[model samples]
Target chain A: MLAQGVGIVETIVVLLYLLIVVYLGYLGWRRTKSAADYMIAGRQIHPFVMAMSYGATFISTSAIVGFGGVAGMFGMSLLWLTFLNIFVGIFIAFVFLGGPTRRMGHRLDAHTFPELLGQRYQSKFIQVFSGLVIFVCMPLYAAAVLIGGSEFIATKFGVGYELALLVFSVIIAAYVVMGGMKGVMYSDALQGSIMFVGMIVLLIMTYSKLGGVTAAHQELHAMANVPSLFKGIGFKGWVTMPEFGWGQAKYDLWWIVVSTIVLGVGIGVLAQPQLAVRFMTVKSKRELNRAVLVGGIFILIMTGVAFVVGSLSNLYFYKHETVTGKIVAKTENIGVIAKKKRALEARIPCTLLHIDTNNDGVADVDVVEKGHDVVRDGQVVLPASKLMPAAEVKDLGDGMVEVRPRAVAFLRAVVQTKDGWMFNTDSIIPTYVTQALPGWFGLLFLVTLLSAAMSTLSSQFHAVGTSIGRDVYETVTGKHGHGIGVTRLGIIIGIVIAVLLSSYARGGYFIARATAIFFGLCASAFLPSFFGGLFWRRMTKAGSIASILVGFVITAFWLLFIKDEEARAIGLCFKLFEKHSLLLDKPNWAVVDPLVVALPISIIVAVVVSLMSKPPSEEHLRKCFRGV
Target chain B: MLGIESKGILAVYLLCIASSVLCVVYGLLSWNRGETVPDDVKW
Candidate 1:
């Protein structure tokens, strides 16, 4: 297979790049004269490094593989989320969240995200608990990233999934554990450059393959309304939009697209730990300023390229397949049936189907399971045997609606197996990448996959190590101030655990689900206190604690209890020893995009709780509020 | 986006330039420390 030969050469080049990264990490390790150097690169990094590091950390494997895939499934509307990511995730996050985090980091001499939060309120419990949370959850997130990377390599390079996972995970773990944040940042900048070049090249190649944008758009437009069970609900027979009512065809629903993709990711970007640390790395506000321009340009290109190419995937697929029924299994006649069934029957994933055999809102009741149980009614309901008609849900004058079941059930059956517009919920990136790139170009595309996965995994490992070494290890042993070497050991432990979790992980959308849960929990606890501590002078320690605790608990409850169509698609699980959840479906938050509901609640609780609690010391307020 | 349906790569290039300008302007406005940003936390 000369194709395989090209792939092998590509792989070797990538490995060489990785080796250089590991060497940079070693240099960072050697440069470490103190804890600060290891953790924050002595807080004296240049703006260029800061920007690249921020970009690298932000564009995890989730971007290229997971969300990019989603764009393949949905149409390009997910591109709006990419725009929001740049504006909110980067721009607002940098201007709004970055400055204070730096000041707070310096004031408290805090190193990690947990340390910043913990020291802000003078609570060891906060630090330890926050650390524990990151340690415990980061692996799941890390594993998901590993899975995305590994899956891509297996798909594109013809490497075994297990082998790819091990190789990629091991490389990242080695660098992160050995290098620390500086190593991570240094490698991130390099990886980020590759990512930037790779994405641009990918976009060019994608367009070239399709003959041009006009041709691509022409082909894509043909599938605009080919045929679907649900037409009135604006189901453009495209996977990008959900089926609701006349105004909701493919990309029509402003709320679903804005709420789930835009706000969920956009706002959540402010609170991510790995990305936050980059703010603290730069030498001064000047460097931060310089980074703003460079980082903005880089991100715009990276994300813009991803969206443009990803949206054009429809064209590539159409060119390749030439079947107008639309390759998005969800848009297919049958896929429309599944959504109809799920909506009408109320069969969410946890149960594997919508039947209320157990009658609990939890799809917890499964009739029979295939591995993880694709659908459950306390019995095996074979997916729809044939195409089902789409149901029309008509608007009754004033925002009211009624659904026709037989038609809905027909669409649901097709959707159960065939992907349609709703298929953008997951697996879209894989489909598009495979279709868009051919031969060496495809192999080059694999570099994007590899870089994304490795960078994300590095952050996961770094967070895991930092959390365990400082929080769990210190807390359980009641030991304080262990040397850096000891913490490196803790990092090793976290990596091993992450490897195990990823190896056994099974979800079509492990990355999105894991990211949602991780960020949701982070937002619940951190967003409230982080903002309050910086803004409200009267925010008390008692209020902060209450807000964090309340936020964490409520968000978890909502995710575990509430069931929504978006959530069911991603799936969810809990605990270190989680059994195969009989209910394959998860709540909307399980995809776990947190900002939609979790954020507002976090803010409200923090404000209210702070008002009702003791205020921080006047001195503490002065330190936090001095510059402003 | 005006007549985006009709124009081709030239529109894309022009749109790109306009976008960059907006981003630069936005970054400057936000970074201007002489004025305080709403909800910005000053530590």
Candidate 2:
């Protein structure tokens, strides 16, 4: 199959979309006259705008591209995450947390999330610490989002990864530095709507192409029992949930599905500074109440569709499997042709080494490795690249012998396959979109993904910048000189950091998991303080500080030392443990996520420490919980 | 284990769409009725 390139029509559509984004940035710049306007859009955003911006920022290229790609590998079990996003990210966040955050934030004249915590506790230390954490840790989350966008661009447009990263980051940075929150929100609304529509179309197209949901799932379920690399980790297919338990009895995907995918991202939304700040963007609790449904629906479509389409891409590849053969190679034809020829052909360049077994006109082919016969049922069909450099044919006592290529070895096909679809799960969605959709519509979908990335990136840059300028610099120095300018400068610094980090974001790092880690980290660090600070009258400054520090440190330590994935990814103390984690059997330590452990610990720390220390002053408690 | 019922997936789809439509309708109806913000309050 030929990989689709951006044609003139697609290019025109994307150029037009860019023009609109520039116009929206101009509008945001015009409205952003003061520091207040820049930070929170003057705290009077409409329900629709607030909801759209929140949903857009909450779901980024990570959710669509990264997590969606995960769905391709893992299947519909990820839909549980969509449920969590709607329930916790929107409903509980807006209904339970949003009102108090807004009321308290307004009363304290808090400009950022850290500032709100600082004033609530009457401690500059809390503010600066929170800001420093954001400044340091947020680049990881931002870089994940950056990679999500750039990966799509690289795959879809055949652009260089570095070039893609530079282009998108610069485009997003341009608006965020100029327009601030208003600009971010404006673009977010536009992008959110595009994402919604694009996902809807994608979903419809996927189901229709796969002969509806039932048939598609049935076909997928038929393929469930394939051997997996993880011990005791064979898929039960696309639709079924992995069985759950503790210690050794759990299914292989149990820890991943329940702990990492569900709890990590689900609970993590509560503490996300970017999404939490949206509650304060609006004027009242009523708007939040109204925004909940929109947010929920937007989340459903964005995540639900992505996940559905992602999983269904399996069917797409299965029906149109790339490495096709059962071909008998002839001496005259040294190379095999691709069985399923679309556009991009399989790039495995295997030449048939002929042997005359019977010495007749017919060539009897038998693939052998290391003096052993590598034939199954009188036929040999293997992926060409896997056997390379290590494979040598042995003398089979027969009339003739030969080996056939996996598929046609187009130059472009070389990069798209290793073994087959299992390795390139991340590219499934991009490949599906380019192949399945019409040229004009595929371009639109590409633009929609770009919009998702930009909206989320803008919000991240704004949040991180505000943290640096307001929570760190101004609080420490007791100076608010050119606050907006300082925040803009912070955005520039953030972009550079994110882009640099994105270069290291190679390998098969799923965007959703990366985003989930950020959320988990945030939840551990911030959820305890946020909950205690908002609701508990006896919450102490010491307790809040302890909770934040413990949560942040423990989660980071767990990722760096305990979690095999993060430890290995960063090469930091992954070898410290006899087992990578406490859960399950040794070696392949199948276990719970860091968030599941750290969040509870942080909460307990906050409660115990608060009990041990003096209660918060009456005025502080009243200010935080006044109208709630 | 029993497979995920197709009906359930359909229900979820309907529920998501219905809820979204409800939110937009509710917001549109109650937009101007919410507590009005003072024009010049600097947050």
Report the C-alpha lDDT of model 1 over A459-533, residue by residue, as the tens digit: 767767767776556656767666366568767777778778767753344565566556656777787788877
* Predicted complex 2: CAPRI docking category: acceptable
Error of 1 at A280 (Å): 1.4
Report the C-alpha displacement of residue A417, candidate 2, in angstroms: 11
CAPRI class of candidate 1 = incorrect
Please compute DockQ, using alpha carbons, for every candidate against the native two-chain complex. Answer: 0.11, 0.25
lDDT of 2 at A259: 82
The per-residue C-alpha lDDT of model 1 at residue A498 equals 73
At residue A272, what lDDT does model 2 achieve? Answer: 87
